[model samples]
Target chain A: MSNFINQILQSEKTLAFPIMTHPGIEALGKTVREAVSDGEIHYQAIKYISEHFDTIACTSIMDLTVEAEAFGAIINLPEHEVPSVTGRLVNDLKSVGSLEVPTLDKGRIPQYLLANKLAAENIRSKPVFSGCIGPFSLAGRLYDMSEILMDIYIEPDVVNQLLEKCTEFLVNYCRALKATGTTGVIIAEPAAGLLSDDDCMMYSTVFVKQIVDAVQDDNFTVILHNCGNTGHCTNAMIASGARALHFGNAINMEDVLKQCPENVVVIGNLNPVGVFKQGTESSVRKATQKLMTETAGYKNFVISSGCDLPPFVPEENIRVFLETVKSNNV
Target chain B: MSSELLTKLSECVEFGKINLASPYPPQMKGLPGADEITKEALESGVTPGEILNDALISAMNKVGQKFSENKIFVPQMLLSAKAMGASMIHLKPFFANGSVQRKGVFILGTVFGDLHDIGKNLFGMMVEGAGWEVIDLGIDVKIEKFVEAVKQNPTAVVGISALLTTTMVNMKPVIEAIKAISPDTKVIVGGAPLSSDFAAQIGADGYGKNPQEGIVWLDKLTA
Candidate 1:
């Protein structure tokens, strides 16, 4: 086990590791566009959120579009909303064969790496886990999600070839992130959750396992995150060999914990959008307390937002969530 | 022989076998897929309506049920949709003329500010397979677009989708705008972050947890 996971296991208090960075934009009075495009701004957002909130780790923004943008996919960066891939870069086997694996200097890769470096150097109180899109998710972005799903059956070889390229790029990217003095990365593979368990193992986890083997170590951990999963692909997620598995609120947290081993740390799954962004402060407290009470028996369970807390989530709701979890002793 | 061929066509769609050349389900490889069997069934004196009701809709019903039960996922669903699509190509002319009629019109779109459309597309496809005429407004659909669609097809049912918590809030005003224009239009809301309570709070007539659930509600309306 990595030192990060060991520390988490040794800690008596159930920790909070919400995938958040948008709240800091409010603190810095910066637009979402500026924070996502500039490394210094992104690092400042992480730092501000870390200093203000009592979380187990300082996690970078979970931007799924950065890697796709690096691969030349068009992106739409809304002023207050998270960026998204607007157009696909690869459409056919010919395009897939000619697609280039972008260098570390491409697109927003440098900005994210700098943010992790700064956060690792400055945030001594907690580990800094950088975020990146998983291989299948990246390939889906480049090839188009619906197209890839159909191609996975109709053109299996083409999909596998594209996945191989995606995995190659991710391994290199993970290595670069590790060199930034960060503890590990949360590879967001929500796209994999859309597949059946067997297909997920064949198309997503096999490649993700390659990345885990390449970069994961005692000093570096990998937390596999899949917000789109609805309890169908939990075993496939476990097969990725990530030290920790983070799930979205689409499934019951207790059901997932039952399927997981006690040694591998399991974190998740308060609804970030429903409870944190839209629900009342009172609702947030109830939801958090409910989750904590349900998972109290599992030593490896850690409380967290199911996915990233989107922009403009109420501060009072986040406060209520953290306060409830802190007050509830396992 | 005709019934057996229809059974083959239905199996092709249920298993996502697109055509003979498609290599999807390993067991079904080298056999006739939805395309070949659908065409063959037509030439063998199978009426387009019989093919429509007995094969395509029947297969999609099972697909939707499996999806709701979590027995299948998106890839399988997409394959089944593609197979159904392949069969639909042969039946379009019959519907274009006076030989057959669709159930009703379903206007669909992802709410504005939310570009995610996978869920919307799946719902649209399932509704289409279930014999409804779907007018897709695509992603990032504006309020006016939906209101205008409702105005044009006043008697049509409307389905709005959103994948983000931020965008799900937008469903309320869109629903309100549609209701104001066409007070009798049955509006349905769906997506990942939605709940039955949220749907009711937002004044949506119904909420579909999955595409299958939405199809069930739509079928009930026509029934």
Candidate 2:
């Protein structure tokens, strides 16, 4: 039986699995023996995930700074690391007035589109997720964080104005990526958790609702991902119109499961460093077993890390997670 | 602002009022937010040290407690921080003159291979709000930078954050490096990939489940 199917059978004692790795794809080099090096790192991520596990996707590191870069912010692309913006786009609130929704073809948008297209072809029959930076996170990237927060108070109108444009860009980008044949899109909104419940409803949820509403369809699903403590914003995320939610390690998986609507799927609560990066395979397997048992019998759950996998995590541990799950099949 | 006004300003901060002109919770809109009250206290002859200690520090302590309990979200805490920041602007001269005392120093950064920092930044701000002087190293930080920071600060607490699973592993050696240099320096670890067990394994002195928890741990260490 497939390891993934065995996991579904609920007989596995362990269920640790590796999260996607973006840079590892680049390490494959240009050798023909490494057939995985067919396209960008994101596509290679899809191929790698599909070959090893039940699900397939990239965490979208084509450059975390892509949108910010396109927004005319100065970006620092270190040779060995993912790109980041050095400063904010709206250094002054006056700059926000000039900003507009960028074309999807601009910046690294083409890279995502192409990656999604390739993932669609390589990850046949498996769920392929294309991720986009949610409006608020992108806004922080475009504008320096300090300035953004200051603007939130001194010029909320400008913040709102920028949010609308950012939302438009993200929605269009999500739709375009979805059209590339992805099963879903993961909206990475690490910044939304920073808002109060009302602000979440007003700024975060309001914009996200518009995006989800604009992208509604059976062909694609929206998975909300916030890599911050999101317990306060979980309901707001649900209200924002996502079908699933992915959270950081700080969140209580049990609490999230209990609080979220029954139909809302929950993926992950693994200690990425504790188990996947540092612990032994046995430890990882045990943790997965514990997690599965903790939230047992709920179809709304998927075994995943609390967040993205660390690059140096041993692949053997991942193999062990799959093996343990497969071995447990009833 | 008189000492009495400073005391009142602190109350405004403790409850989270951005400025005297703002009305968030609606009860204190026109009465005076942290901004106006703090300024008023300063003008009314309140010493900067009194404002920093009695008003700003005390208010942030309440904000931190509320945050740890989940009674507040990022926006509320941020508002409190903003209020604190606005008030701190007036106290900068006092710090320069040695009239106000900062608790200690903290050097914070996201671990290598991790690109996310919203959590890391929030923790830095919160720690700063708690009266510690913070030197933010920003995201995708390397181990050497931390070593250098520890070398400079000597007694400064080192904090490492990583929001990505892929990047969290890099923290292990970073933590080890700090201990190698200054074993006495407290090492606090947080982020999405870490937990208490992981923190223990990494030999970190403490692990915060959230930014507020980090501040609490730091305060306890200094206390």
Candidate 3:
């Protein structure tokens, strides 16, 4: 096991850390309205988390929006918050045709690469996983969803063409991030679960396979995380070549583990809001214990939230998560 | 249409037989599906109300109830909704002509800062199946958009879904915005990172832990 995973196992409590540091902006940490003001503030946030937690993860908030924004999608940034694209991509497939592969130096993508490196280097050996958005999610952000959905019938060719572009950008971005020396990558695929089995196989799986295949190296783990109830796509997700699949707790854990490939690690399923965000520390500990027991003797697994830990989640709850894992060793 | 025909229609819906063109659920492959059955009922002088009540609505209700009890999930509910939608098109004229009345009105969206929408989409279809007219504002809906929706449709119940904790906080403003526009408009919230207490704390009128719960609450309000 990696030292980071060992610390989690050795800790007397449930171990918890964030995936990204808030450099003010959701991505890049540049001045996009509510950006992190400057790099110093972002550094302080990292320092604070590292000083307190057993581990620290990089903070790259808007990694998902970078490629879409570069692709002529008008992204609006609310002051001190993450940026969001203005409209769905279906309104103008022609515009996507004009889109270029985003260079690392051009937009916030490079800064995220920097942030991950800094977090990894600063935290030294503490595990720092770079959370990247899925191709489908970035495509959803770039275009109008209603149009893309309709294109599934009226103009599947157009949808395929656009997805091709998205896949290119996503693969390139993942490759660039992988080159940066971050411990691993977490591909967030919230939109993949929205599609039917056929649509998911066609639209999501191929791109995911490309990214995972492109980023895999002996040094880093490429984790794929999808939030919400993904009971239907569990098997397909494992087949997408992700080393680990992080999904929400709403799904039956046993069912998911059963579908997982032996080499594929399973992470996550804590109810982020309901249990971690709302419950007391003891309850969080108990929940973590239950998850650990369920996965007893499973070598390739990690305890984590079914999704992102809500920012306002209680610190004590995090401690309990680490404690539960420690107190109950497999 | 004969009672036997209606029964077949209900079965198609229960089994999620969308249209003649679909070949899913292999047992029903090459068989007449929801589309053919609904169109046949219309041609046979079946009242839209009977086809809707005895066939489409009942099947969807069963799906919704089953989902509430965890017997089925999003994919099944989605298929059932597709079947219901196929039948609904045949009854559109009835709705337009006021021969058939929708149960109520619902306004739903994913809150700002959250772009995820599977939950919202599921809720929209499930609630629509439960007999309400749904106005989906879509994802990343701002507080102003919600306020405008509430102002434009004063009687519509509001629903907000957020998958991110950062975005779930936005639900509060949407609920407050709707309340500010029309306090009488009921507001319900759900998402991965939300709880009933969070919903209540945000001043929402109700909280649905799942899509089916949202339907049950909407049904109660309309009833």
Candidate 4:
């Protein structure tokens, strides 16, 4: 692993979702979704965020949609809120085959790539892990989610073809990301969590392994995130060869962490919504401390939000979370 | 023969056999499905109430319980829901003719600023299968819209869902506004972001971890 990966391995820290958007919505007086589309604002937000928490990530705002939008999926962008994929672009084998993988400049991808490069060049102390969606998740966005699940059973060849194309684009995207002097990439495949372990292995894990092999090494690590799996497919997720694993609030973090290889890093899974954005300061601190106590035995464990913390999460709550982690070092 | 029809209809729903034309489940391929059996029941002089309470609701309850217990999943529950919907098509006319009754109405939606609806749709379908008239407001519904829906539906139990942490906080206000206008309207809350503790904290009447649990709550509420 790279020195950055090696460093994170040495120390326990609180790493989480978009800090720029959290402050952008609360302090900067701009909509985070809109701000993230602009690389300069995204960099500034990360810079502003770095002062608060070390080992912060580049703006992971809507990492789920960039690939789908690039593949010509219609996106519904609301000014002050998260963007969503509106219509499915792939319906059948012909449609999946007709999909043309767009260049790096397609949609708002370059902005994210730019933000990663800028953050890496500026922030010299800690790691700047960039975020991207995984192949199964990107494919799920391009087609109907439920249909894709059923299709995996009935139309395996078509789904595999779509996954191949998705993985091809992701491999290219990760290569471009690695060239940007970033520390690592977190490939989020939350949609694959909805599948059975066998299906997840066949469809999600194998495809993610291809990307991991292509992009990851001792110099650059791959962190696999599956908020959807809820520990049901934890074994399949670990087998993807991602150096780090991040889970969601659907399953207990302590239990999930136990399933990880002893050497691998485990990050998770405070309730980003119920406990972070919506919780009071005392409650946030209590939840974080409780989680720390629960997972205290796992030295490989790193405390993090179960998923991305939403915008306008009270600055106080954020402070308590960071402080709770810092004060209670294992 | 009549009891046999009811058992067959229930079996069709329980097994998620949509129709004779549906080729799913492999072994049940060529057999008549929920739609075919429900129609046969009606023609053979089975009452709509018996068909609903005995076969349809029973089948859905088993599905719901299985879902809660992790015996089946979303895809399977959805298949069962599609089968139930197919049967409901033939039975809907009986309600208009005053031969059948509904349990009560259920008003549900994903709260404002949240666009996710797959969970809401499933819950609505399950509640509908349980013999309640479900008024789904769809996603990104404002609190005023919820209040207005409560005003219109009056006695209907309200359910609110939010998939995001930001939008889940909005569930509190929707619950507040609906209760502010109609205190008797029991408001239920659920989502990936919400917990029973949060639901109780927000003054909601109950919380459903899954759609089946929501139906169980609604059944107890109207019971």
**Best lDDT among the predictions, by candidate number:** 1
Candidate 1 error regions (>4 Å) = none
| Candidate 3 segments exceeding 4 Å error | A1-48, A56-62, A91-99, A120-122, A145-156, A195-201, A258-262, A323-330, B1-44, B62-97, B107-122, B135-160, B163-187, B200-206, B220-223
All candidates in order of DockQ, best leading: 1, 2, 4, 3
- Top TM-score model: 1
Model 2 C-alpha lDDT per residue in residues A1-330, reported as the tens digit of each score: 222232333433333323465324534442221222234666775576666654334444434566766677776544434456775567555778788778876766677688788887666756667777788878878876655754565568888888888998888887888788777777878777776666667767888888888875666677777756557777788898777778776677888889877666677777666777677988988987777677866666666777666455677776666665566533
Tell me the TM-score that candidate 4 gets on chain A alone: 0.94
Candidate 3, position A220, lDDT:
69
Candidate 4: regions farther than 4 A off: A1-5, A10-21, A24-27, A56-59, A154-158, B143-148
lDDT by residue for model 3 over A217-237, one digit each (tens)? 666667787764458767667
Better of 1 and 3 by lDDT: 1
Over 4 Å off in model 2, which ranges? A1-41, A56-63, A78-81, A91-93, A146-154, B1-4, B18-26, B30-36, B42-45, B105-125, B128-184, B196-203
How many residue pairs clash in model 1?
A: 0
Using DockQ as the measure, name the better of candidate 2 and candidate 3: 2
Model 4, range B24-115, lDDT digits (tens) per residue?
Answer: 55678899999899988999899999999999999999999987776776666777888899999998898778789999888989898888
Candidate 4 C-alpha lDDT tens digits along A1-330: 656456656665543433234564446566666665777677666666765664345444545787888888888776766677876799898998888888888998899888888878997755677778999999888987767866675467889999999999999999988888887888989888877777789999999999999989887888888988766789999999998888888888877876887778888888777787789999998998998889876767777877777767787787888877778863
Query: Comparing only chain A of model 3 with the true chain A, what is the TM-score?
Result: 0.84
Residue-wise C-alpha lDDT for candidate 1, range A104-201, written one tens digit per residue: 88899899899999998898878889889999999999998999988988888889989999899899999999999899999999999999889899
Between 3 and 4, whose lDDT is larger?
4
- State each model's CA lDDT, in order: 0.91, 0.71, 0.70, 0.81
Which one wins on DockQ?
Answer: 1
Model 2, residue A49: what's the lDDT?
Answer: 61
